[model samples]
Target: MRKIIASLFISLDGVVEAPDQWHFPYFNDEMGAAVDATLGRTDTLLLGRKTYDGFAGAWPEREAAGGEDAGFAKKLGDARKVVVSGQDLSFTWRNSERLEGGLVDGVAALKREPGGDIAMSGSVSVVRELLAHGLLDELHLMVHPIALCKGMRLFEEGEATMPLRLLSSTTFRTGVLHLVYALAESAGDATYDDAKVHLPQDEA
Candidate 1:
């Protein structure tokens, strides 16, 4: 079975929105390499309607222009993209297709396929649903140093408490922490907070 891995850019206040505003400044070669590793591992992409529209608008043209992210842009453009949407998508980007049924059942079917892994990023709605259904196999959070104070959080109010086991933690010089977690079998033992492996704050 293919694993469903979600990688997200998040802020200190648990805000997952508009990572481009504050998240980009902290990015470096190390971060790029980390992102490369994740992208390399997954052959398929699972996106919600919003993220699908957003990325299709960006990556295809970017690849055509032979820009900075052209390689990755082309990679995404060429990869098989499965979008979770209610209405039928008229025109998606290259090699894209829409799943025209229930999100949970459709995605669950995708997981049963023979593949390396399926990658999802920045699709908070879909991520929440996947997490709730225990469909997500690996969760990678790229925690930035700054706090937005207000934004759509990764974990929202009235969200159920889902315990996770800490898998690994890697800190960059740019103060971005890469935290990996797996869904824990026993809440009495492992918790998500147990995954916080902190590093020294950069004194400037």
Candidate 2:
């Protein structure tokens, strides 16, 4: 089964919206390599409508312009993109297709297909939905050290609690934390009392 990996550039306050407004100041070679590694494993791009629209508008143009980012742009343009939207869309970008049915069913079907891992970026809603439905296999977060204070967060109030187990963590020179997580098989039964034995003698 192909894994559905969701990558996001998030702020210290858990904001995942509009990273373009606050993400670049911390960009470094370490972060670049981390992102490159994620892209290296991705064969298909699963995108929400908003993210798809942004990419479809900019990437094709960037690919044609032929600049430093053009290579990455071309790579994005070449990938098979599946856009999730309730409304019908006319995709002009090559190798783009609309998700056929409900988000859960469509995505579950995609996971069963034989291919390399499916990757998603900047699709906050899609990521939340996938994670909520147990369809997301791994979540890779590049957590910048700044707090946006006001924006959509990966987890919001009234949302169901999700327990994730850390698979790996890397701290970049820029202070951005690259965290990889997978859903926990169980929300462990440990409580505060279970940690009492480890308390410092003075504190106890």
Error of 2 at 76 (Å): 0.6
TM-score of 1: 0.89
Model 2 per-residue lDDT tens digits across residues 155-189: 98999789899999999998999999999877768
* Candidates' C-alpha lDDT: 0.87, 0.90
Give candidate 1 regions above 4 Å deviation: 189-204
Q: For each candidate, give its TM-score against the true structure.
A: 0.89, 0.95
Residue 22 displacement in candidate 2 (angstroms): 0.4
Q: What is the RMSD, in Å, between candidate 1 and the native fold over all Cα? A: 6.4
- Which sections of candidate 2 miss by over 4 Å? 202-204
- For model 2, the local distance difference test gives 0.90
Per-candidate count of clashing residue pairs (backbone under 3 Å): 0, 0
